[model samples]
Target: MAQNPERRAALVDAAIDVLAREGARGLTFRAVDTQAGVPTGTASNYFANREDLLDQAGRRVYTRLAPDPASVAHALETPPSRELVRHFMHDIVRRVTADRTGYLALLELRLEATRRPDLRRTLTARLQPEYEESIRFHLAAGLPGDRSTVSVLYFAMLGLIVEHLTVPEVIAADPIEALIDAIVDRVVPRE
Candidate 1:
């Protein structure tokens, strides 16, 4: 079907709002239409099914959350070191916290993906290249450790992001950037 990119993008953004606010069970075409303030059936017309809507929403969230190219390039210019990793980690925490709703929507997509094989496949495919890029960046930067270090750092940051976003009280004692720096210090290995 011919799709209006602007309308489709709006509906997908509306879907993100619905996912973040209502959770996966509440993410329906009607909810997205309502969130977008469009007439009923608008979302359904744009998205063939829930899976397609979710896939688009997930991609949108990634696009919104990914680091800026200029910032990444600047960081890449510096040699990879513990300080560099900490800087990037701090940037990530700031970005996620700044766009908490988007990240939460992504978390909702992750949960939805667990139950839906199609979504799981799509999300996994979407993330594979990012993971590869991180590995390449680490190697190129000459960071210590290996892919396993990258994996550990990824999951640990993810856990921190989840906790920091959901239950601020759980980590309220430590400053977020400090906590991120500490985590990066422990995981990235010394130069």
Candidate 2:
């Protein structure tokens, strides 16, 4: 029989809470069960395995990082010029500060991907959209429009994520601050 909806959500929420509360190593069925107020058996029934559980957590993470309608509206209404990209960076900084757990787990997943090839596949799927969207935004701004350029931006964002997750300094590089400045300086508008 399928688990109750409330019960199922409880479990998923619990998984996120557990990851956030206890770090990746502390997330387990037993812990999630207790946190969710479900039986251990119930957790097993729902998830069936650890990877399945982590995948769920990853999806939750993806949703949090995703741009919302309001954010999207802002992006469209205001061009993703250097200044607008600075606002996007502020949002990223706020998220990293507000939800330390998600940021840490995100980096942890990246680190784990080095050893687990399958995890790399999973993360890449979630990452591609962000990459495409960001690259397309810059492309619209008359930035470089090429496959390799997009790949560089994608990996550069990943690198920045890791750096901030580990260091999380009070003052950090402004996202797109330098990148945008360089773009403005180098690329004269060609009409």
Candidate 3:
């Protein structure tokens, strides 16, 4: 295994781009190597196998997309209100739209997971924490609704994000901000 954490992270980042750009079939170590502009077999030295690479890519996607803690903390310090929730949803949309490739890659992983139980398990393990953390954040924010509400909001936002990112034509007719406001209105408890 590579002792250089930076090198390993770079390989993982490259793997994410390959997976997103080429899909699973094209996500070879060689592909990652090319993407990273490193010598051939550089990815192999860091990753044990395809599953390992996929796992790292999946994990990397989340880490890359995670919200800045400072921002989250600032928001948390503010009074918890439906308005705050709406602001949060807007931020979500902004972030997702900004990094369409990363989200698209994550969508690819979701499809790949269906065909491969091992990959599914790997992704589930890597992604389940997102849900847990979301719940924790909601609780800390004193946001209304039980876990189920958070779950609903999560899935709804995910659906909107998926559609917006993948098929702009499907929903481009309507303003996304309006749509997000609507979602937040329905999901978050009324102040």
Candidate 4:
């Protein structure tokens, strides 16, 4: 069945907004329907259950986590790839810092799913795509590691952000920036 592109995009945007605002706890069929300004039945028609919606939303958010290939290309279209790097860095910081609430919810989702191996399997199914995207992005910038490096970095970033949010004393000052810089230094060679 074909989908309406505009509506699909709106649903995705709504999913991000809902996730960012309320976390996984707040993601329900009716809630997303309201967020998208569509009818509850409409959401149901698109998603069979809460898990389906959340999982799909998770995928959407994961895909859009950073400066995508198109944006990277456009940013580098001019004289300086510096603009592209800056744009990418700016995007990364913004996305990571802005969606703490959602990230926490995702963490909770994982935790809850731990009791049900089937659910855990369903939720963790997202890890591969997320891992692949990071690996591809790092590789695009000439990083020398495989998917494992990207997975490790991705998990570490989330862990650091949570720690920084929950226990500032345990976290070093300028942690996010430091991590970003370290990642950049590895992925993008310094002049």
Best-fitting candidate, scored by lDDT: 1
Clashing pairs in 2: none
Show model 1 residue runs off by greater than 4 Å. none
Query: What does candidate 3's lDDT look like per residue over 1-191, in tens digits?
Result: 43689988999888878877889888999999999999998888888899899888888888778788898888878788888888888888888777777888888888899988999998888779878888888877788777887899999999999889878789888989999999988888886
Looking at model 2, how many pairs of residues clash? 0
Model 2: residue 51 alpha-carbon error in angstroms: 1.2
lDDT of 2 by residue, 80-148 (tens): 454554455456656665676676767656666676787789989877777787767666754433555
> What TM-score against the true fold does each predicted structure earn?
0.94, 0.71, 0.93, 0.60
The Cα local distance difference test for each model comes to 0.88, 0.66, 0.86, 0.63
- Over 81-170, each residue of candidate 1 has an lDDT whose tens digit, in order, gives 888888888888889988998999999998988999999999999888888888888777887769998888888998999999888899
Off by over 4 Å in 4: 1-3, 70-91, 98-109, 115-119, 132-152, 164-175, 182-191
Compare candidates 1 and 2 on TM-score and give the better one.
1
The segments of candidate 3 whose C-alpha lies over 4 angstroms from its true place after superposition are: none
Question: What local lDDT score does residue 122 receive in model 4, on the 0 to 100 scale?
Answer: 71
Which stretch of 10 consecutive residues in model 3 shows the poorest summed lDDT?
1-10
Which candidate order results from sorting by lDDT in descending order?
1, 3, 2, 4
* TM-score (C-alpha) between model 1 and the true structure: 0.94
